[model samples]
Target: MAHRDRISNLPEELLLKILSSLPAKDVAVTMVLSKRWKFLWTLVPRLEYDHSMYQDDVDGSSRFSRFVHSSLLLHEAPFLESLRLKLDHYSCAADIGVWVKTAVKRSVRELDIEINSPSLSTPVLLPWSLYSEGCKRLVTLKLSHTTLVDTSSSSPASFTSLKKLSLVHMKYPSQDLF
Candidate 1:
């Protein structure tokens, strides 16, 4: 009697659904399980990156940033179902912009970004790409501690499919922009 790998034998869709429930970092670790799982994480439609989880590390900020970049770059899902980012003061505006742009490009249906940086004078600015045509598929968008400037006059910041929007401590350039 030998042990059989029944889990691996399951359909890829089922495996992907299982992986989606886990954090992006934990999902990525599944790659080492076996050859069958080497690229499974990349196909998972949901990604959650929480910087607070690595606070105990010596260089957790940089490590977390790198992990986020790598994960987004490697993600192969045709349409991302969700993208959630919980960042701290160490995260830079440039990195945040890039991450949002990547998510928009992936046609992410749900986006939740929260930045905790009370000490900083200025918050990270949301990228113009977020309001562009690429985000037409976005269903839910939640933002916190970020500046939103209506930079895209051409696209007009439309979220046709958006069902829910939550903003917390978000700065806007003008009342007219809303």
Candidate 2:
């Protein structure tokens, strides 16, 4: 009598569905389970990057940023269903912009980004690409503790597909920008 890995024998679609329910960190860990799952996590449609989880590391912010960049670069999903980023004070504006742009290119339907920066002087500015045609497929967008720059000049049709939008502690460049 021998033990068999029944779960591993499941179809890739089923495995992917299972993997999708796990956090991005856990999903990445699955790659080491076996060769069959080495590239499977890359196909998961949802990615959530929370910087707070890496706070224990010496250079947590940098490590977290690198992790996010690597994850997005390696992601192979044709259509990303969701992208969530929970960043702390040390998160950089450039990295945030890149993450959002990448998600938009992937046709992400749901986007949730929260930045916790205690200082009012260093506000993270989202990329203008977020208002481009690439974001036409976006259905839900949530942002916090960031600045929405140059929104006044953007076309009103930019967010036509958006059904839900949530903004908290967001800064606007001008009072009439809305």
Model 1 pairs whose backbones collide: none
TM per candidate comes to 0.88, 0.87
Cα deviation in Å at residue 6, candidate 1?
A: 2.3
Candidate 2 lDDT at 65 equals 85
Candidate 2 residues 1-178, lDDT tens each?
Answer: 9988798999998998888787788899899988888899999998888878875457444878888899999999989999999888788777888899889889899999988774545456666657777688889999988887664553553786999999998777675643
Can you write out model 1's per-residue Cα lDDT over 91-169, one digit (the tens) per residue?
A: 8778988999999999999999988874444556677778777788999999988887666466577778999999999
Give candidate 2 misplaced runs (Cα > 4 Å): 56-61, 118-121, 151-157, 175-178
**Model 1 C-alpha lDDT versus the unseen true structure:** 0.86
What's the true lDDT of residue 159 in model 2? 81
Give the whole-model CA lDDT for all candidates, comma-separated: 0.86, 0.83
